[model samples]
Every structure is written in structure tokens, then in C-alpha cells.
Target chain A: MDPDELEFLGEKSKIMIIPTFNKENIHLISGDLGPFRASLPSQVPLWVATLLKKQKRCKIIPPDWMNVEYLEALKEQEKQTSGFTRMPSDHYMVEAKLLLDCAPDDIPNADEVKVIIKDIWDMRMSKIRSSVTKLVKNSDFYAAVDNLTIMEINSVRPILPHALDNLFRMKHIEQPKPSQNSNVSSFLMSKRASTSFQLSNNEDY
Target chain B: MDLDDTNLEDLNDSNDSEDYVHITPAEVLELMEETWVNEKFAPEILPNKTEVVDIILEQIKSMEVNIKNLSNDDFTKNIYQLEVDKLRFMVTSYLRTRLEKIESYVVHILKEEEKRVEKGESKYLSEQEYKFAQDYSRSMDRYFNKIMNFCPNLTSDTWSSKVIEPNNNSFVFMKSKKTIEGLPIDITNADSDLVDIKSGSRVIICYSSIEELVKNGDVNLI
Candidate 1:
């Protein structure tokens, strides 16, 4: 199986739907989605549930993880524990964002849920930021982080990897003095362009 | 094996064959990673990653066979095995990371170009990015070919059609679930049969039919 598919397999979304017809079952490569009945809740992949909800064939039952109470507790646990706590799924943040954006009406206390999720997310992110800053300041070559979420890593993807690369370069090369060094670093950062046509002439690659 | 060659230059010259034949897998992996991370957006650096992977695999395989023929020197054999394992690990990690980016890039470019066109911006990729895209596409093609070579049963008409038909502006595919109207699409399952698609049922439709469905969250592109 594809790695993406494997990752997605755990990201099933619960949805309440009113089917046009009484379908027995649908066998998909991901798994079998079964015996859909009108006005009943069923578990389906996030992609499928989102589609059904959009077409008015079904309404989404916001997953348990999206509950404001649960999120608040999660945030508390995150604050108290030195280690990471479990999330409902690997792609929970992306899934939550998708559902909240598309079907806000379906989710209960949608605004509150959003705030709590954001709170937990920000708390986690701030912790990540501090650790990363420490690593940079101390010039640590390797630091093992336990249970860092995929979303957390992805959120910092644009900077962290490139920062590490720059750090690696800095370690080997002699310093060019402070002002010249700042210019070089800024030049390097600017090379990380979103598009090809925006390339600067001084880009090494 | 030469006792008289005491100079550093002579010592370095003795391992010339090992130097020529045995490129460090970590270096290859690093070069490939750089090509993926930096050169992917522009065609400035072209390290043939696909070819490098192939050469590494062949080298590892031959080394495995050679190690089997050595004397019962468990100490040396264990070290050789350890080095080979490290190389294998590096290659696996490198390929996994690169392929993930390649798959995402394929989807990204299609959607990105479409958005650019709709926004009345110049939709054409810079010659460098276009070249990089071509290289990536070719690498993907080669990767799939190698997979099919190893496991012919996995090769299906649909798989090839989906990957190779890059020029088709609109694609017909099945909807895994219901979706709304007016969003863009990613291509998938081009040659599959059209069936009566309901929620979680398959349907055959073009890209535009499901644009909104794709954007509004009714259907997946694949």
C-alpha cells in the first residue's frame, strides 16, 4: 500500500447521512463502507464523508476529537505533561480544519471547538519554537524529540529544514563578519522561492 | 598489501579502486536530497538520482554476493554487513522522501498552473522549473517501470494511463464519494470503468464536472 494511503487509513471521519437509496455496501481499496441508511450516522474516510456532506446526501457528525471539552482537557494535559499526549489521528488538524471550514453548521459549538483546538495548537507550537531556538543557540548537531506530531512538523516545514541546512553550512564555513554574514543568510533565505520565475540571479542552484 | 609504500600519497593511491567503485551512499543520498529540495524548483543542478539509486542497488547486491565467498572471518564479515545495512537504510529513506515529494509535486503543478491561468497570470513555468518537472516526471516513470519489472502483476492498464497521460487537460475518473460544484481537480483512475456512482460509489466524469465538488469537499480527484 502507498504510504499516504496507510497514513489516511487511520483518519476516518464519522458522518450522519440521509442516503437516496438503501445501499448494501461499497468496497473501496481503503476499506468497506457499509449499508448506508437514511438519517443514520456512519464512519467513513474524511475524504468520503466530506464529499457526501457537500452533496447534501449526508450531514457530518463532528468527530469526538473536535469536542471543545476534549480539546480543553487535551490542552491542559499538554501543559502539564513534559511528553506528548496522543491525538485522535495523525491528520487530525488537517481533518478538523477541513470539516470546520466546510461544514461548520454540523459541528456543535464550532466556534468554541475552533478556539480550544487553536489554543492547544499554539501551546504545542510555542513549545516547539522554544526548543528549536535553544537548539539553534546551542549549536546542537542532534536533538531527539519524542512524540512530535506530524502537523507540528509540517507547520514548521517551511523554516526548520532550511534552517538546519543553513546551520550546517555555517558550521563548516569561516565567518564573513556580522554584517556580511547577515547579508549572506538573507540571500540564502530569499532563494527559497515559491515559484521558478521568481528566481534571483545570484541563486547557486 | 604493499609494505614499501609508506608515503601518504602512495597510501591514498592504493585504495584508488575502492574510491572509484565505492561512492559513499550517504553522499549520494545527500546529493539526491539537495536536488529534490533545491533544484526541484529550478533546473540548475541535475544529479541523476534515479541512475544513482540503480547503481547503488547493483553495488550492494554484488557486495552481498562477494561477502558470501570470503573466509570465516566473522569480525570482518560483520563489519561489511553493517556497512551494507547502513547503505540500504540510507537508500530506502532517500527514495521514500523523494517519492513523497514527487507525488505531491505532480498534483501541485497541475493545480498551481490552473490557478495561475485563471488569475490571468502567465501560466507557463519558468524554463528551469519546467525542466525540473520533466526530470521529476521521468524519474517517476522510471521508478514505476522498475516496480512493474519486479512485479508484473501489479502493472495495470489504468496505472500506466494515469501516470503517462500528462497532456490530457481533462480526465475522467470515479468519484469515491459525493462532492459539490466549482473547485479544481487532481487526476486519477483514467481508464477505470464508469459505474453508477452514489456516495461511496464509482462514477466516470471529467475534471470540470467535479471542480466544485473537489473544492467544496464532495469528491476526491482520484
Candidate 2:
């Protein structure tokens, strides 16, 4: 390969190679494989088991010439990767739950809602079984799930307080006792009763 | 004989009442004038812009003198702690007043500009004037940012204050739990989502994490 192509690959991989001693003979042999190996970090051999699986073109270079640049390149790569990585699933779920609880009135769009549900799902899949069970048993998780489900159901039809109350009661791990302020309850009961009565009348006709 | 009796009777009543009650046209007029004087109408009182500016400048001059005196004082006993506290308070007070003054001045200028615009005068300023205004705003913003960044350090007795203390024996405790043990992790790394489990599992996730989760199928429900 041409030096330009090798340099382009080196830059992309964040690695640089330097030939030593017999530059001509070494360059001729190294040009084929030196750039490829130079493009990888020292840990590449150990971490990447698939390297042996690929067709062998040349011998792997010794570790000494890899130098500080190789280490720095690896560090930069790791930094970039970690900087953009997803937060742990459990943490994301907790954050979503907190946000939803704090501002339930200001419902986020479908996309945002999905993100929260996914975090809960991921937590269920990856977390320790006991921890998962604890989460499943947790009152907050169920409340969040109920709130989300009610919101989803409401997206199709106008939300009735009766439906919301039922959902809350069904899913709530330790449900709070009903209070005297039953404005929402009364409104929902009247509306649902009137609607059902009208439907029955229509069916008889 | 009857007319003379009636006249005599009226005279007697007037004389009796005169000793207990008296009235004069001049005195009534004088009372009316006094009432008018007391209830004198006038326009609503407001400080003139120039007067307000003068008051602020005077207060600033006084503060400058106070700051000068503070700087010159021999605060030897508990000198280090006193100096830092005084300096911080002084700086914060100064910045607050300065910012207020700048804001007021800007408002005044803008109001004038608005009036000019209403009169169909030049709505846009000359290039030089615009540049000057922009530069002033930019400089103020920069100064404000610098002051805000330095505020936490200045106020905290354990952080930058210990460096200037006389004895140098005062142990500067790191308020952040992450730094108390002096772990090998990078300072930037401390800001990452990875919990330092040893440090009580202090978890932090950046905005980027949420964005990524949204991109990936993991957070499809949003």
C-alpha cells in the first residue's frame, strides 16, 4: 500500500509507526503488516481474540516500539468511547421515574416515554435477580408503570379519573388511603355512568 | 309699649350670647386659607435619572473607601480566615452593585433608543456605536462568568483559602467525597456515569447518555 493510504488509516486509528535500523529492508517487509499492527493498541492482541481468526498476512511486531503514542492513542479512544456511552440502565430508570413523578402534568412525547420504559426493561434483563425482584416489588416502579400505561391508554381516548384510579389501585404496591377530596372521582363516575347508559340505550335501539 | 319691650328682649339675648360665642368674617377666611394650604396638590414624586445615578456613584465611592481600608488593615490574629472572608464579601458586594448599575444604565440607554425610534429618528446605530455596545456587553459577560467561577473557591474556607493562610498547617479538607481518598481516576473521569463504588456509589449521568439511550433500542419508549 502507498504511504498516503497507510497514513490515512493510521490517523483514523490514531496510531503512528516508525521504522528503525535497516530502513530499506524493514520498510519493504513492514509496509505490508506494520501499519495494520500499528493501528492497534498493545492490548489489542489479548482483547481481540478474532485477530487469529482472520487470515495471517505477517508476524505481529514486538511491544517495545509501540511507545507512548500507542498508549495515548488507546487512552483517547477509550475516553471517546466512555464519554458517549449510555448510562447504566438502572440509573436511567431511576432518573426517568424521578422526572415523571416530579412533573406528571407535563407529559413528554412518545419518544421520551419509550426511553424510560426501555431503561426499566434493561434493568429487568441485566440486574441481579434479587435486585430485579426488589425493583418489581418497589412501589415507585409500579406507580411509574401505571402512570405510563394510563397515559398510553389516554392517548387513544380521553382520560377518565375512574380509569386512572383503577390503574393506580391495581398497580400501587402500598396504596395510599382514599381522601375526602373526591372531585376527580365524582366527575369520572358520573361521566362513565352516563356513557355506559347511553351505549346500552343505543344497543337496545 | 309692646315694640319697646320686644327690642329690649332681643338686645338682652344678643348681649348674653356674645360673652360665650364669637364669630368674625376675617377669621373664617383665615381658616379656609389654612385648609387650602395644608391640602396643596402637586405632581407625583420621582427621583430624576441624574439624581439616581449620582446616589449610586456616591455609594460606590464609599464602598471603594471601605475596601481600601480593609486591604490596609493588620488582621494578624485569625488573619488568614478574616482576610479571605472579608475579601470574598467585598468582591461579591462590589460585583452585585456594579452589575446593577450596568443593567440600569443599559435600560436607560435602551429607553432613549426606543424614544428615538418612536420619533422616526435613526432606528439603527452607526457601526462604531454598535461595535462599542457589543464589546461592552461581551466584556461584562466575560467578567461575570469569571467572577461566578471564582465565587465557589473564594467562599470555601477549605479550598483556595488554606493556600494563603499564615501557619500553612491548616488541613484543607476536600468537600467532595470523590477527592477525599485521592483516587487514581482522572478529574474528568469523576464526571462520568461510572460509579466509584468505594465512594458510596455516587452515580452521575451526562445528557449525552440520555441521547444515546434514545438512539439505541434500549430507550424506545420515549
Candidate 3:
């Protein structure tokens, strides 16, 4: 999956935003948003907050975990742990990236927060790289991938799965009594993990 | 499609019930997003969710109509317009992803659809999709035969044999939606790893091992 697509999914997470304009609740199919009282903070999906922010209608209130100090501690723990440290949220990277991208000014010490988040991401990626190498070389059939976020998982995709699949094909369980025929299945899973559908010709709404 | 039958259904999914209950469009949108991501990741095509999709699309259309009635200078217009655009993006992306899979795995999908029919199972492909697959398969066959005329004995059978199929054995990182005792990891080994996968636990496992669970929505591939 493309990082943008993952970010799209991540945009669904509700976050606090202070709207400058007052309006009745905007009824949307996904959910309702704001009877915006000026300068009063309300929680809305990140996507909504982004558009409002872009239109200069709202100020994004960064999530509590987006703080530099908290992330620095998290990064320290991530480095100390041999295994992947559980992220603050399943879409932590996604939320961080989107929030940071759209409203850097809303966040305090935004620069420091950005640096620490990247550090955490880099550390996690290195861990995933080493772990993947170990998994591919080992005889273990599967590994528990606890704490890996969607973006991290997507990074290893088509490659990791296909590589393991090819290994499985070559091995084909040297022993007997396999329920199904390994020879019958794909020798190599297609490198193309189906392109993310193009949306360039989108109808203006 | 006229899409006039925009009536939404309640939680009671029993086949015999001829009833309609109030279900908010909000809930439907969330379900659609989940289905979209699941379809995007699953190695094989999933059961058709056209009914749910139709309902959501219907809601979007109605929303659009309402937005059109708003005064030109209304500030709320942009918000509604933006929401509609985003919803359309989500739905279209879901559909386009499915279509790509259908085109790539036409032969494989048709074959499995037949097997599923024999077992009296619900179809994975909708009627329109099934037709599309058949037509695609036929056209590919014709193209193959046309090319084969210059070759030394090639047939549709040969073409089918060479079709690139989705590898179900591929590993996927899945978040378990339910706790299953002794879930089988790989059965090739006599003492295959069989561990309890608790609800909300994430793991990397062979798709073939949890294919059934995936279809039943017990796990979501990340």
C-alpha cells in the first residue's frame, strides 16, 4: 500500500481542533462535526481538521503524544528494547506525519518533535530490517509481528511476503503428509501487489 | 444503476426478516473503509459487499443533493462539499482496487467461484463482476488463440495453466479480531506451531493458514 493511502486511513483518527468560525453541526455521513464556537476546541477527524486548517478556519491541537519530551522517552525505550516497542497508537506514524505536515505551528517545539519522531521511525525501521533478515534465513515458519504499525508493515510488503513465499516453495516441506500440494501453488508470488487504484480523474464535488 | 433502493438495514441480518431498521450513514462509512483496507490487503478476492457499498453511495448522492440546495454564499457549503469528495474518494478507491484484482486473477477467480458454487457457498463475486471476469477470460483466450496460430500447438488449456495466480501462501501481517485457541500456523510439519492468538494481537502468518479466518473477518491483514 502507498504511504499516502495509509495516511488517508490514518486521517480518520479524531483530533482536537479550534475553529475560528461558529456554525451548526455539519451533518456528514461519516459523522457530525462542530457547532463551532470561536476559539473553543472540538474533536473532529484529522481530515476535517486539515481541510479547516487549510481554509484558515481552524487551529489544530496536536495530540498529547506528539510532544517532543514524550517521544524522546519513547525513542529511548525503543532503542533499549530488542523487540519492536508498541507504538502509542496503531497509526502513530500516520497521525504524526499528517499533523506535522499540515499544522506545524500548532504544535509546541514542532521542530524537536519532528526530529524525535524521525529518530523513532529510523530506529524501528532498522529493527524491522534486522528482524526480517533473521526471519528469512531461519527455519521458523512464521514470526509474531506484534507492535508493528500499518506503515511499517506496508514497507516490508510484496517483498517480504514474496521472499518468504519463494522460500516456502523451494522448501516445499521436505517431510511427507502435507495436506495440500505445494507444487500446485505459485512458485513466485507476483512482485506487483496490485497497484493502488489511481484517482486522478476524480469528479469535483 | 438507478440506485433508488437506498433503504438502509438494521443489525438484524436474519434472512427471513422483511424489515428495515434505522442505521446511520456514519456507521456504514466506517464499515466501508474497513472493507476497503481488507480488500486492499487480502491475497484473494473477498465476498461481494455490493449491498453495503450501494447503501453508502446512495447516502452520498442524497448528501450531494442537499448540498446543492444550499445558498452559494453559505460557508457550510465547502464543508459538505469536502465531505462528499472524501467519501467518493474512499468508495472509488475501494472499487478500483477490487477491479484491479479481478482483472489480474480472472481465471483463478472464476475457477474458485465454480468450486464455491458446487459447495452451495455464497459467491465472492457479484453478478456484474462475474460477468466481467467471464468476458475478460474469453477475450484473453481469443487473444491467446490468435497468438497461438503462429505457434506449434497452443490452446486455452495451455493458457490457463500459464495464468499468474495470487499466492495464498504469502505471509501477511494480521491483527486478530478474535481469540482462537490453537490456531494452526503451518501444518506441513507434524508438530506445527499451534498457539492461541488473542483478540487484538498482531502476528505475521501465512495467509493460507488463516484464510478461513480472514474470510469470516476474524483477522484483518495490515
Best by DockQ: 3
Q: Candidate 1: which pairs clash?
A: A51-B178, A51-B218, B178-B218, B179-B218, B180-B213, B181-B212, B182-B212, B183-B211, B183-B212
lDDT of 2 by residue, A1-205 (tens): 1222222212212112222211111111011122233234222221111122121221223223122343344334434542222232213333334334433333334244545455434433333233324533442111112112211222222222223223333432143434422211111112221111101111212
What are the DockQ scores of the candidates, in order? Answer: 0.02, 0.01, 0.34
Q: Fnat for model 3?
A: 0.53
Candidate 1 residue lDDT tens string, A1-205: 1334323432444444445445566533223566877766666666666656666666777776778888888889989986566666666777778788888998899999888888878888888788778866875433434355545654554465445444544543443333422312111112332211221224432
TM-score of model 1 vs. true structure: 0.41
Tell me the TM-score for chain B of model 2. Answer: 0.18
Which residue pairs clash within candidate 2?
Answer: A110-B222, A111-B222, A112-B222, A113-B221, A113-B222, A114-B220, A114-B221, A114-B222, A115-B221, A115-B222
DockQ of 1: 0.02
Per-candidate clashes come to 9, 10, 0
User: Can you give the lDDT of residue B181 in candidate 3?
Assistant: 86
| Cα lDDT computed for each candidate against the true fold | 0.50, 0.28, 0.78
What does the lDDT read for residue A59 in candidate 3?
94
* DockQ-sorted candidate list, best first: 3, 1, 2
